[model samples]
Target chain A: MTTPTPSSPSGPSRLDPEPTPRRDFLGLASLWAAASTMLFAAIGMMRLPKAAVLSSPSKKYLVQLPDSLAPGEAFEPPGRAVVLFRDEDGVYAMSKVCTHLGCLIKKNGDGFDCPCHGSRFGIDGSVVKGPAPQPLAWHKVTRVGEAYMVDEGVAVPTGAKEQA
Target chain B: MSDSPIKTSQSALGRFWRNLAGAPRAVWRAAFRSGAPTTDRTRSQFVFNNIFLHIHAVRTHRWSLRWTTTMGLGIAAAAAFLITVVTGILLMFYYKPYPEAAYDSVKDIHFVVPTGRFIRNLHRWAANVMVVTVILHMARAFYTAAYRRPREFNWLIGLGLFAVTLGLSFTGYLLPWDQLAYWAITIGANIAQSPREVTDALGITAYFDPGGFQRQLLLGSDVVGEEALIRFYLLHVMILPLALSTLLAVHIWRVRKDGGLTRPADADRRLGPPPGDVYPVFTDAPMKTYHLAAVVRGRSPAVGKGPENTVPSMPHLFYAELAALMVTVLVCLALAITWHAPLKEIANPDVPENPAKAPWYFLGLQELVSYSAFMGGVGLPAIVLLGLGLIPFLDREQEGTGEWFGGPGGKGLVARSAIFGLAVVLLVETVAIGFGWIREWYPEAPQLLITLLNPGTLIAAAYALYSMWLVHRYDSVRSGAMGLFTCFLCGFIVLTIIGTYFRGPNWTFYWSMADWPKH
Candidate 1:
């Protein structure tokens, strides 16, 4: 056994400093792994919602149309243009939207008047007033047996015949 | 030698079978670097050679493995952390960190992705479990006196790990971007903002304010917005986990250096004598005398105590941990599959969640803030932490190191302290009701000073004074510390329960949880 010298510090003792620092390579490697992961995540985040798929809007509307538009009668569906006109042959569908500015037209004497831009249309959607450039566009109406199925996506000319 | 064709073919097939079964012996030796431990020498070598098993000691104390000693809280915490990391990584694939898209992306995750909801729920619940079990781990360490002497530094590291665990939870709370997530984080951020309250009350914030410093540092703007979202995401994903992993490595290493846990004095004697070759004697002198003379740090030779009352980490601890991991993962998965995580309407800043809670844990602090911001947010929390940090330094008695509440008389002392602690907590809570006259006298005083002179702080100081007297009376600060720690825990639990259930809109008091509105 070696006796301790007060002045000498060297030893074959188990009093040497730890191997703890030597194991720090594990920690450093873990951190580097974390840094690289963050970089990859950053790169991933750079790719935006560019490939997001938006669903297209449906083009069909189910509208109930009675046999005829008698006097003081109308078909004003909520959120849809009201179609009201009394014809000798049958009931004719007229758009309540003014062609002048696309504002909803209210019922008037023998026709409709635009609340927004002061444009008027005859009962058959013919322009009977100024500031109205063309007649109201017609939504092609198809008879689905009992009620009318309007092709709202396809708007046709007013005087043209409505499809069955 | 006229051999039949069928017999000759069978001989060739036998050769193929022998080669298939016997091949890769060289490769297996190269990979393992050792044969299976049929002997003691090989068992030690097998453990030391493997990268994964090297962290665990070849042999461990029976007490350390016993259910009551640790209750497997620390292992559970570690296992929960593993779950969080795995589930969190999977979640990162689906989560987008933008205000407008964050909520929708989460919605898409719920409605579109398969098993995505389960992953997210498991991540959340695992985080909560991690936090709770970590606190329980700390309590176990304290009660067992594992933080005594050489293990004190490890205590500080453990404290850091606890804080980081909470930080992990806080950062994750904001990711979902629902009204609940938004306002919950807002309440937390607003709590962070309370540092300015003291500074502003003092009128010196123009020069420097650390509270405002933390606020601006965290939030790029006045409120929780795009920058806050990104910062929280980065912290949750990378910065905190990296810190936790490093600290955990150090903590485990230090545990070995500190002489495995501070088990009972005769734990090794109970296991009979140490095995001869397994744990070869390392030093000529006593470890105690050597350590005092010269601070030497390395792996303790006491690790290989013997296998009678100890077992190999290879199969024993590893299998136990695996069982814990399996149970935790299954429970979290079951919870995830059965109940979905909360995702209220797309975070509309226009519509606020009234009486917006700051998660259940922080609701205690929030409730305190209702009484006083400085005391609740900063002062009281500081006191609790300082008290905990000062424990080892204050209680210098090592006589009762490995026992609960300190020594043989611990049960009696703790029971007395528990009674004292509960009474103190009750007195602090209800003192204001009795002291209505003080409020009447100070009707026109500044609210800050009114909060400064709150009854909770005074009653607590009085309790400390009384406990200090008892410490002198019994000649033991350990008893005092026990009383204070137990009191703080009771107060925290009570306040959290009250804040979570009984507190209503506008911070009004209600009789029970049912009294609160359905919303």
Candidate 2:
């Protein structure tokens, strides 16, 4: 217990001029504990959305290329995110998902055109026109027996092809 | 137990009749804790004691009850919301929140369940009505300058409620899982992902994109599917409603604390004293002590500003509220009966709707998005909302506080602003649609340049410059705010109308839907 002094005219209280050192330490400790608790809780919440197991279909699928498909033609598998192209060199896969906003692009006469925004990708997946910053991504392709397996989850370098 | 000694004079039958005669009064007293309110004291007590009526002030200004004052828009909006809640609950009992079954469930509700169709229609119409009424209510508050002084926080709360209302509507729009719902939500989701435009242009989207995160969180996946349906349903049925109700409680409480609905500061002087004034003693005090709920360090201006020209809220204000509510319900009922809510073909992602549009309210935003994805959808709306939030603080002039268009000179200013705003919006839209923009002439233009120089940005810039000129000319912040707000409001209306009616396939301009080429 301290008596009121000339310097501290209002009251002889621990909080008058400033909190006592012990009180300040305790307050700081409590604040840190509360903040860390909130941070951990937020981190815990972030883990919930990334499920270990997904019920949806896998992104990697094997596509049987139509025998009649010409060397320079593009064949898009129904309901899949990848479009397969077989040329004289080999079979390659390009992502149907637009580089701009992820709208699946439709195959035009010479290239691909995005329906959402008017971004156009050429036959080789290079951006002919854009709001699309980069060209369409190329997906990893491997020959699984006669059918080609395109892995949408893995991006391969542009023009990388599975040898025919 | 036998009653014999005290009832010697009365027969058994007479005693029973006497007991029955007093039963009604006993029940009434038990329920109300008071007699019928024939006097001002009882009426005040009736309002103060009742839980349902307690949100209202015990005494309401007579001016507040006028048809022109608030136009009962707030009450109507609340009533419409109530209707939506009741009907929405009924809908939840039968409606499934799964992607596979949602459309089927809606179809069953339409064709099978007892009065489900009517309830669903009512819910749809009521939600629409709530949106319209809420917007009109906001417009009313703005035009009358009711968002001034102590009521600014309440205005912000009201704005929050407005946002929650739209959130509720947008979430509900997806529950049907039809083509209309699917495509509309897709367009909306894309708009939510508009920040990718900026990120993409800057070549940082691969590492960082808040817009993409928002869209993913909203949809619960990359697209509107099983996860999106459940997420939207949860938000629509539970989270948003909870938020809205809580905000509404605060909004109404703030209204009470702000000393009821605002009127001109000199309203009492103009109207003289109210007729049949019984509380002369309460009103006549030079320094009303009842208002001093707390001790003050200085001379407070609120010392003598007691309530004026007021009537008991029980019969006067409550009656008006009830009337407004009834009118709203009747109108909704009429609309529900006359027109059925639309249900389109089941959602097909592969075969997309050619001119896929968002809900009517978001059409204005969608129209903007057609010009430039990021600026139109994200930037412009953000700026508008920020501007709206800052208005009360910026225009601190409290002179024409509670009058329509801020009184005489204000009316002329607003009119001029509206016309100017309309002209600017139309001109910009026409030029953008007819002649094309920067992207058309400079095909190789940078995405950032095109994004920054779209029709939406042009209109916004024009409006800003015009409002600043008005401010400089009038030498008043309030007038400037008024001009800007009116211009934006006009632009919003014009854009919405065009988006809803004039635009067609591929978002191309059309005079009418009749002119749209058949697929």
Candidate 3:
């Protein structure tokens, strides 16, 4: 055999540079698989909801009342709106929207009191408290040819008086 | 040639005088050898030829000098660490790591041993200064972008160093075993164990339950007591220091590898040819001819010799670092002599502490814990910290622009917008937290309004979110400015009105015994 020449001024000549070690390949493969699995798992976890759902039955009630109630009289309905009248027998359904801030008013004794700001409204929807400047809003109840249907469409201002 | 013989002799004499005064013949002989190819000997010759001697015999940047800053800081910190080791050894002579002896040992340090207080204070102040200096150095590196490119790995190492610093501080904090250290560390560890609130917000839980086993492993028992003191003592003295020193060496090595301090261009050029090239050799034979020409012009060849340039970590840097070390040592000594670290009454494991506060750095988080158990306890803070740590990984661009967001070069508009939004949210939350109790006391007018604003804190948070969105969409700068102003104002209001004025004995529970039945 011909004399093998040295690659450089350094020691030793390699014969067919040693094949890649099997352990290195196995180690690299395992690392790759582990990393991929962790990444996928993290992404999957992000889609879950953070808050618990509330379970209460009282939130679903609806309100129903006669077309119109007389002024100075009030209607406390379970579902939709609490009504307060401004004058006797002359019907008016006052929406319970509290004038103090916009919280629904609860009827106390002779008038309506706002729980949020403590604003009080008289039987006729007049402002009785210092915090609330304006009276409670009165809903329009038109007599459509004696059928006694209350018009829930229009809101009548508390200051406006209907002509007979 | 024959007519100028007298002139040539005079020139030769003048040249000899010049070489003697400045560039000595011996220096030339050391620089270049006769009958050798210049290229073959260029590298070695360069080192000896230059008057401004450097180890590498090449030019480099001046900002590279700040690497010296890091090194100097580390050395100073190490000196403090050494002091701590010596003092700790001394204390161990009399001190016991058991709970029974820990407090007694502290008392001995204060009242019993001669100059024991001095040793203890020296350790404490050195630690405090080390932490502060490390932070400042980090900030300097961050602003200068010294952490960019090849240096990123070192930055990570630095982060590890920072962690070690914190660990050392924490473990040392408990050595005193008094009320302040005990409660503060207890709260601090609790905070660490609690899931970060931000992470919870993101609905992510890498939940690994740390049972009593883990606690025992960490504290050497279920609670912070004698076992904990011993464990902390070991960690502070032995484990962390070893880890820190090992990492510090690696950190310095990486800096050397990356390239010495980044300097202004002019300063860099003044050093010599750029790094890697050998400077030209000045041989005695050539020197004699050059000197003759210089003598003919009646000028000294070495008159314009510039200031010496050096590679970082070389002799020049070594001296500067020593100077910095001296200053640091004197400061540590002064602090050790005058001040005593805070140590409260002995801890009673049976009594629960009221309104338990965390360490100062964790006050923001502790305040957060007061919000909601789910949000404050687990969600928000975790996300914030994780996100902060992940910033470097997320912004991986190659550009050197100093914008806070995105990979290096892109405009930081998105990042700025995000920061602004976050600022707004924080401001709003502060206000909400501050005024929540007041609003709770004064219910809104209508029942509906009360329902809407009953959790006034939530309303404030919602408002803050909305404001952030607004800033993101339109007024970015204004958003940040307003958000900061609002947070400040709210903080002031809370501190003055709510915290100082309204928080009474009922609110400010000093010890759990205040509320506990005295039977």
Candidate 4:
């Protein structure tokens, strides 16, 4: 549908096929030849590394009991960003993040409180105060050995009794 | 059947490949619609047919091919994006944006998971490199005046892409959930409260109270929590990247449609008449040529578009792309091998870092915020971005572009602007620090005056006014604008370096980073 205009350099007014030397064809052909050679070389070099470098291991973590933690106390995993409760009932792992704005709540008397604002949650992770839209999340705690593995992806309601 | 001696050897393997490629003819038809193109016509056709090559023009000007012309920064940025996408997806496999698991997942990646740390390093480093390279691309375009005339809208789009690039990086900053990520983002979120500072300073703001708007907009609440995390995570992983990719396609397409990059101003004298056949035909005839004439600022459409000086996109552009990508990947790999991405303790809001800082990109703003939050964080950056966007409209002179600093004293101008800018910024900073000392000594100065009346803002305003006076003195708005831009860039560089390394406990100055105690 489109054509080059005569005023432009690409139109019918500009084609001087007679002026192009035959040797120009050789140069043009050799350009492709050189490109293909480089292409093969690059592919050959990249292939081995591409094949060898990839290995994806699964990300499931198995929690083991450390010497510092015991059965009757609440411990926040220094790295895990979760608060674990180990009492007579069961071992519970709750998300330390305030459900309202996401700031980690500090442990207060019989409850937790947001330091940024003042959203409060009970010891079992239920919302005891306003501004916190919801309760702190309870997670799935599975028993691997003597210790418990807490899966933070799973969420549960407050006061639900679950054993690891 | 047994083959002949020649056919029985490597020719047999060759024949097999030939048969495989040629089989049933339909397989070949289904695959390479433009097959084994060797000639110029067929090469152009091949490029036209291929989806990848469709983004590129069939031919490119010789100047555009020169490494110095672009310094390969844009191409390298694109290559870095490719690396980011690959590595980001891999990182996402182990990453969860949730609060409890996020920090732990980072630790696992660092210590336990196979190649998780490696991929994270690649993603982090490549993302950083991409931001830098994109900025360099903007600078290259600006210095070369590639955003003039027909390319004005493209410049705006490029700015949009720059914003998205920063957004991508900023959102990604919080993914690791370590102390560094937490505090850095906290500082960034805090800086978002800048608009309110001005509003609060004015008594009228007490009733209207738009101060919390920016922070709430960024964080969805008073603080950074789940909503912030999820929002940042989605923006980082999906929305911003998608937007960047879409805009990048359009930006490149416009470059090709607008008749490639603007060559050097005097290039017409060097390039004479181009062969007619080598000129790219548009989808229409006389109308298209007229449009091209309008777009190209017509001398002749093909004046500099000769075949001898140009090359086809098929091999030349592809080769350049491949080379850039290889170099980028190797560099990224080297960086990943050498330096580990920093991950501190998990997020603990109760015990904050002594001098908590924003990420390095925004550290310049943070440095400014220490003097005056609203002006430094919000007003200054807005002015720079808007001013940059308005350059094409503002500087209408036709001849003085496609070269460094836009004049005969280009390099000299750059050096002078740099020195002037640095001296002003440094002097202002030292004085501001000195004022902090004065406040400590007096203990009677109003905090409000200290907050808003710092010498930093005063010096910056004075510098801007002086630059405008230069515009009047030189009778050139373009020259004036260049001076300011160079000044701002130099100031930004100095501020970032200072903020990243010098400040210590209680936000006090340290002579060297090594002198700071390792908490």
List model 3 lDDT by residue over B341-393, tens digit each: 66677875432233334344334434443333223433443433343344345
Model 4 misplaced regions, further than 4 Å: A1-164, B1-25, B271-308, B437-452, B517-519
* Better-scoring candidate (lDDT), 3 or 4: 4
RMSD of each: 18.8, 5.0, 22.1, 16.6
Highest lDDT: give the candidate number.
2
**Per-residue C-alpha lDDT of model 3 across residues A33-145, encoded as one tens digit per residue:** 99999999887764332112222123222233345655445666544444634353354566675443234566778887654334567776776552343467666655455
Q: After superposition, how far is residue B209 of candidate 3 from its true place, in Å?
A: 2.2
Docking level of model 3: incorrect
| lDDT ranking from best candidate downward | 2, 4, 1, 3
Q: For each candidate in the order shown, give its overall lDDT on alpha carbons.
A: 0.68, 0.83, 0.52, 0.71
Query: How well is each residue in A63-123 modelled by candidate 4, as lDDT tens digits?
Result: 6656566664578756565788766577778888654334566687788765433446788
Q: Which ten-residue region of model 3 chain B has the weakest summed lDDT?
A: B401-410
Expressed as tens digits, the lDDT of each residue in B327-355 for candidate 1 is 77777777777778878877755434655
Cα shift from native, residue A59, model 3 (Å): 45
How does residue B97 of candidate 4 score in lDDT?
90
Lowest summed lDDT over 10 consecutive residues: which window, candidate 4 chain B? B280-289
**Candidate 4, B272-332: lDDT as tens digits:** 5445655444432334325444234545565544335566776767788789888889989
Q: Which segments of model 3 are wrong by more than 4 Å?
A: A1-164, B1-61, B66-79, B196-208, B211-216, B264-314, B352-355, B372-430, B437-519
Clashes of each: 0, 0, 32, 3
Error of 4 at B310 (Å): 2.6
DockQ of each: 0.01, 0.22, 0.01, 0.02
Model 2 stretches with alpha carbons more than 4 Å out: A1-56, A71-74, A85-94, A98-137, A156-164, B1-28, B277-306
Which TM-score value belongs to model 4? 0.69
